[model samples]
Target: MIKKEDDFFSDMYQSINRAFADVIKEFGGFEISKKGFGFNPNFDIKEAEHDYVIKAELSGMDEKDVEISVEENLLKISGEKKEEISDKKGKYHVSERKFGSFERSFTLPPEIDSSKIKASFSKGVLSIHLPKNEKANTKKIEIKTE
Candidate 1:
């Protein structure tokens, strides 16, 4: 029941959608590593008695481009990196660093207080501090009933 005009418009819609996605990539902030590229975000995730800490090296990303979210026990980090110069034209000598959308995640412990987590971005690094819940911080002592 689809008409030719409807099909044409649908194709247009898809094209426009792709353009918008490009715009998002340009300004949306960090680029996740492309498939088959052996590069990762390069982060350090560590656990302490209180909570877990994550440090990520996002060298070229601004504050607005990175997105961090925690759902249940999963912590997600996503962002885009805007290439310094896009006017490649025809002059290219060396291209090494990869650029695009990137995402990383860690499995957080159940005791983490996601709501109270603190994040600070400086230079090209993003440091996050997650504090444990009060109950998780205290040691439990079992009492024997005689």
Candidate 2:
């Protein structure tokens, strides 16, 4: 019974994921229309004590192909993933990988220091660190009783 339930939930989750992907393909965001490709890399944004870190998973992509920019509070990550299908190889029996260009934009908090942003790519993962401004640093406040 447990196995059946797990399978049912897994199937439902997969269905939802497929549907979401279809929607993304149908309605691309940012530079989706310009690129004519439907590949959006997954990313995670985290907040630390003095910085905001964004990590994006971009398998099969070179660091040179990706570009990062920050304007005001808008952060943009754009890249092109070249198709790896070799002309020398025979027709693919199954091709599931996607190729082309994709861009994702995020609105960062105003407290971040865009000038001090740092970015690094390693092992198909892109990490961006946005240092917090001096005014944004955490500080304890005490209330004085009158």
Candidate 3:
């Protein structure tokens, strides 16, 4: 049995509202989610006595395509992934991989030496190691009597 036109319209209206809400939340900022398509809003960061380590999972990506950088206390990760398969051509199939440019930024501690940061990508993971500045080490003090 077919439903009434008003009922169908109401359902469509709700769906549209939810889609709009998603865009607003994405643009205005919202809590991070690990599911579905979209950028990873948050990444795991750890701090050691000697360095600040940042690691992110980026599967189906090549090491040559990623770019990592830090400016002052901010760190940014960006990359583009393409959709290509070497063999088998067909239509009407399930595809769940995301392909596009992604960017993520984080504010690091003041003691991190941005110039000394090292980045490496391996086995579908990207790691950034920011070693503490040379000044972070203890300095000698001189006592003077006047």
Candidate 4:
């Protein structure tokens, strides 16, 4: 009798799980994976009087692992986070950390002087300073009425 009850509950649980996955697929047009996703860092952009500052939070990453470049008006940031090897004898009950390569790009304004841009990394945070061209700064014009 106990075996029959266990089988019934197991069947019900699998049916419910399939129904949930079907609903998610119907709405999102994609199936959820059990593996996991890549590591994408969060960023913040701030504008100052003469320059724009971009900061990216990349925890558990070294400065050498990250790369920054500019092509035309696009600024690109790419990096890889390697996973550590664990003990073969140990078993993991829950693993939630994500490790992989990620790339992010942003379009820079025409007034920005890319040649003079500067970058610094400290405490897992990367900061890029984009200075604006003085000649390209916005100017006000006075209109004469006839």
Candidate 5:
């Protein structure tokens, strides 16, 4: 009787799984997976009196792997996260870490002084300082009688 009950439950489970699979196939087999995809890093942008600052959180990455550049009025930041190799040979039950190349671009304001921009990376964080053009500062003009 115990054997019969186990077989019955196993058959029922298989049947349900088949039914679900058939439904998914009928709906064009929609699947969602994040494996082997580039991950986006969090960024913060701040505007100061004389400059703008951009900070990005890029953990598990080295400074040499990242690149920053500006062209015209656009600022682009790109980097890659490489997967580490293990010396020991073993099967992995579950792997959730993301590793790939990522690129992010921002449209810089005309007031920014692209020639004076500076960037630094430390502790897995990237900081960019965009100085404003001296002439871009607000100035008050007195009206004269014509």
Candidate 6:
């Protein structure tokens, strides 16, 4: 079922939106789904006593499929998830799983010690530990009233 409207502005807006989405698609910015555009995996960051911990959900991906690196103040995590293939081909259903390459980068704070960072991936979860440097560690300063 399709409904056409005589609204010129709305039609122009839709055309612009589609063109923008096409550009994004060309650059692998996101994957268009029924709901909307989806980008990257879900992740969470937590600040601890001496380190900042980042955990990203990367289910169904092996360690060999993932890569992590740090340059300047940016930590990059990139990987590819291969799509599964079934021997018997019969398609007429809903397919929502995302299978492709993805890269995610985070700009770390200046207080982080890049040299002593640690990363571990286990059970579909990628965890990163960024220890704070001595200068960036918590310090107590005395207040002087003049």
Candidate with best TM-score = 2
Each model's TM-score?
0.63, 0.71, 0.61, 0.67, 0.66, 0.68
- Quote model 4's TM-score: 0.67
Q: Give the range of the ten consecutive residues with the poorest summed lDDT in model 1.
A: 31-40
**TM-score: the better of candidates 1 and 4:** 4
Look at candidate 4 and give me any clashing residue pairs: none
What would the TM-score be for candidate 1 when compared with the true structure? 0.63
Cα lDDT of all candidates, in order? 0.76, 0.82, 0.71, 0.82, 0.82, 0.80
lDDT of 4 by residue, 1-146 (tens): 12432456546766776788899988986764322125678899999878999999888889999999999999999888888887778666656566778888899999999999999999989999999999877678999999
lDDT of 4 at 97: 64
Q: After superposition, how far is residue 21 of candidate 5 from its true place, in Å?
A: 28
Please estimate how well model 1 matches the true structure, expressed as its whole-model Cα lDDT. 0.76
Model 3 over residues 26-59: C-alpha lDDT tens digits? 8996634322133342367887778878888888
lDDT of 5 at 44: 100
Between which residue pairs do clashes occur in model 3? none
Candidate 2, RMSD to the unseen true structure: 8.7
Q: Residue 108 deviation, candidate 5, in Å?
A: 0.3
* Range of the 10 consecutive residues with the lowest summed lDDT in candidate 6: 31-40
Clash count per candidate:
11, 0, 0, 0, 0, 0
Candidate 4 overall lDDT versus native: 0.82
lDDT of 2: 0.82
RMSD in Å for all candidates: 12.2, 8.7, 9.4, 9.6, 11.4, 8.1
Stretches of candidate 5 exceeding 4 Å from the true structure: 1-37, 91-94, 139-146
Query: Where in model 2 is the C-alpha error above 4 Å?
Result: 1-37, 142-146
